[model samples]
Target: MDVAEENSEEALLIKQHRKEKKEVQAKIQCMKNSVPKNDKKRRKQMTEDIAKLEAEVEARHKEKLEALAQKPTEPTQVSSITNGVTSLDLGSEEPVQQPRVSKAQKRREKKAAQEKERDDRIAEAEIANLSGARHLESQKLAQILAERELQIRQIPSDGHCMYRAIEHQLNEQGNSLTVANLRSQTADYMQKRAEDFLPFLTNSSTGDMYTQEEFQKYCTDIVNTPAWGGQLEIYATCVWTGGALQFCGTTGHKYREQLVLPDINCHLEDGDL
Candidate 1:
């Protein structure tokens, strides 16, 4: 076969491999979803099967690519007569079509982009918050706390600090809940009452309302991942339990005011230290 024919064959082979891979992936997803959450033995077997199938698919794809690469390359010329004139087309080739992105892949890419943009905003906000005035503000905050006879209770600086702090307060109030329990409960509440929380939540990067899928994903991450707690989570916690979260810190020139959750009322003084 000529070089053009070889290219066409190679593209066709790649397309076939892609189709096979996609079908296998779909089957794997179905298998995962079909299994009961508590069936450890069956889940393990399904996992093994999935891994085997994925390996087989990858091997087949590799073999096809290798076979295409090993094909002999040659160029041929064909003659055509038009209007009593002979013309030779030498090694002419068609452009190889690229694989189309699936909708799921597109969604994944969009979510990743949104996350990156949100991280960038958080970094910028952090940098902006670190100012020379912070020291003075902290001293003023310390004086206020001393006046109120309240001492700062330092929680561990781990990512779960927010949850830990909440748990500590709960324990003091005779409501003992672990951090994991708190996280799961908060995530569940936010998901079930998404409408109540979704209106107040906006995309930090886009300044637009969150789509249902995005909100669901956010809730899922909170439940399944070590996602850092923020305003929405604090609000969810307050709503889940008829309690309030008092936030105190420095904003700009003044000591950042206290924020009461659920009601979202801001008080200048008398915040939880």
Candidate 2:
């Protein structure tokens, strides 16, 4: 006699009625298709059959309500009154009814839910990747553009004036700006960039970021990069975050993927050019 349970059963009754209505409609359609429209007597007979079916459906629904209302809800009390015993009719056998939402339906629903979840995850990952890549690439491009603009402005204006710079230390017996000095400075800058971007590259929050014991070997290998052939030297820079990787130029807008080593471990092991 649980009111909540009764309400749930009522909902199931409504669902069942809807299904029955569809079946009735389909049968009516089939009957109509099987008969000739020109036959008035046959049409009248079909209408009577339909009317009887509707009446039967309504009567059954009313009977169902009455049965539910008269249901022996207090099971334990009833069982006690009957001494928990029933006379067995051993010769009689009742057919078992199949369950609602069959095994096939359950399997299909489970598969559909899994597929939906997988698709949602894929969509989220794709959006994150695209956003990260776009932001990094745009930021790098903006900075490069700004620097080029500044250089252009300088060329037309005070081209002769040496830009403001802090002279940290003086090199002994050195030219103002020798090729060796520039290379050394560029190399240091490249190394620092690699070290700083290590955590972002590796998608990690802890650790020393890099380990370099063979300093000489590392330096030698880096200097021998394809970009270093015949003093036709080139400089490269790559920055990678957890979601995306981007490579910007040192001299121009050129991008070289081979020189642009991605991932934190690669940065630690490979010598940057």
Candidate 3:
């Protein structure tokens, strides 16, 4: 066939393939909609339909590849005789060229697709929480989350968010303290006033009071390691700065604020020590 005829046939085949694929997809979607979520038998049948549709799609893709392979690569040449003189003509041959895609590019595309899928799954899980919660509590929690979204500045949860947050606040006020420096200063203050905090330092895991040696080791870990800072570090920062710290927390229905002080007589919670 001529190049034009061949191209027209390929186009028709592609259009037919697309039409068939769409019909298969529509059938699969209809089957999915007809089956109730809890209907095991109907769900099984829907699964089979999905498998069939996938196979059909794959087959149509293979047909497209076959059509491309069958396409002519050589240009047609016409010869003519004029004034009783014969002329010879050679057909032009043009090689079919396909764009080359690097493995690195493919890998990057795959990674982006996987990351998008992961984010989608996380969003779906978060939405599922609303459906699973008690109605009143769900509505309350939703409202709290909306408010928190507006007011809260999220920091990285890399075991250093608390220290980083404090560092950022200080920097905003024209102070120059790194997270590491803040942690060290807090630990030093706690160590110097161990006598005050030791009485409140109880190990929740073991249900035993912290000995002086054990408390010292805990302080060392907080300063030297990238462990997450909690109430202990908060109070230590308060004492180290010679100021009281105010903490705001919410539990869906209520917002609570507490003033953490340097005084030993202040209320000492498990984490506060």
Instruction: Please give the range of 10 consecutive residues that has the lowest summed lDDT in model 1.
Output: 79-88
Error of 2 at 20 (Å): 1.1
Please identify model 2 stretches exceeding 4 Å from their true place: 1-7, 72-273
Top-down lDDT ranking: 1, 3, 2
- Most accurate candidate by lDDT: 1
Q: How close is candidate 2 to the true structure, as a TM-score?
A: 0.24
Query: Which 10 consecutive positions of candidate 3 have the poorest summed lDDT?
Result: 79-88
Can you give the TM-score per candidate against the true fold? 0.45, 0.24, 0.44
Candidate 2, position 171, lDDT: 24
- In model 1, residue pairs whose N, Cα or C atoms come closer than 3 Å (at least 3 residues apart or on different chains), thus clashing, are none
- Any runs in candidate 3 off by more than 4 Å, and if so which? 1-150, 204-206, 262-273
Error of 3 at 106 (Å): 29
Question: Ranking by TM-score, best first?
Answer: 1, 3, 2
- The candidate that wins on TM-score is 1
Better of 1 and 3 by lDDT: 1
Give the residue spans of candidate 1 off by over 4 A.
Answer: 1-132, 203-208, 259-273
User: Per-residue lDDT for 11-118 in model 1, tens only?
Assistant: 456546555655665677678755654556678999999889877766666665655555663332111111101111111222233456587976775666556556
Global local distance difference test of model 3: 0.64
Error of 3 at 161 (Å): 1.7
